[model samples]
Target: MDVPYDLTSYVRVLKLASTPSWEEFSRVALIAGAGIVLVGLIGFVIFVLMSVVPGSTPA
Candidate 1:
């Protein structure tokens, strides 16, 4: 409804934003990396279980 009015301040704030510090960037990267690893491990475990367990799948 009030598109331009809302985006006006948001655009100004983005224009004034600065690059992330090394510490901040590294923290974000570490969290993202951990999330990716966790998902990958979960997928690998599911795959192993599928092959190792009999009648575990639906027909």
Candidate 2:
């Protein structure tokens, strides 16, 4: 019996195997995500503080 080959699946598997390991990618991704969250939190705190102060114009 002859087996059928799926070229698309083979290509996808090869591409995934050639990609970077999860550990390396996850580390960079986590750092970037954390940085974004930290910046957002800081900006929110500043915004709240400014809003609570009297006579401050909203930007």
Candidate 3:
């Protein structure tokens, strides 16, 4: 309900933002990439199992 209060809070948040070092950026990127690959592999396994199993879905 308070516009000024919200604006000040937003400013405070912006003030805390900073650029990540190359090492830190690379570490985060590697972890994110690994998570994405892991999720994709799990989804692929589920899809393959569903297609190969009998009566898994209505034909």
Candidate 4:
């Protein structure tokens, strides 16, 4: 591996990368939050179904 070349490439990426704007960050956060809530809701539904249905889960 070329250490100097790798270091230069890493530096170039760091130079180009910038923090997200507030609006952009908020949109990302909202989408991520929705996805998390969605997954949790699905899991809760599954748990309720398993608890209510007979023989669906091991006693």
- Number of the candidate with higher lDDT, 1 or 4: 4
lDDT of 2 by residue, 1-59 (tens): 32345777777788888677999999999999999999999999999988999878656
The C-alpha stretches of model 2 lying farther than 4 A from their native spots are: 1-18
The TM-score leader among the candidates is: 4
lDDT of 4 by residue, 1-59 (tens): 99999999999999999999999999999999999999999999999999999999987
TM-score of structure candidate 2: 0.62
TM-score for model 1? 0.71
Query: Candidates' TM-scores?
Result: 0.71, 0.62, 0.86, 0.91
**Model 4 regions lying over 4 Å from their true place:** none
Compared with the true structure, all predictions reach lDDT values of 0.96, 0.86, 0.97, 0.99
Q: TM-score: which is higher, 1 or 3? A: 3
Worst 10 residues of 2 by lDDT: 1-10
After superposition, candidate 1 runs with Cα above 4 Å error? none
lDDT of 2 at 34: 100
Candidates in descending lDDT order = 4, 3, 1, 2
In candidate 3 the C-alpha lDDT for residue 23 amounts to 100
lDDT of 1 by residue, 1-59 (tens): 79998899899999999999999999999999999999999999999999789998887
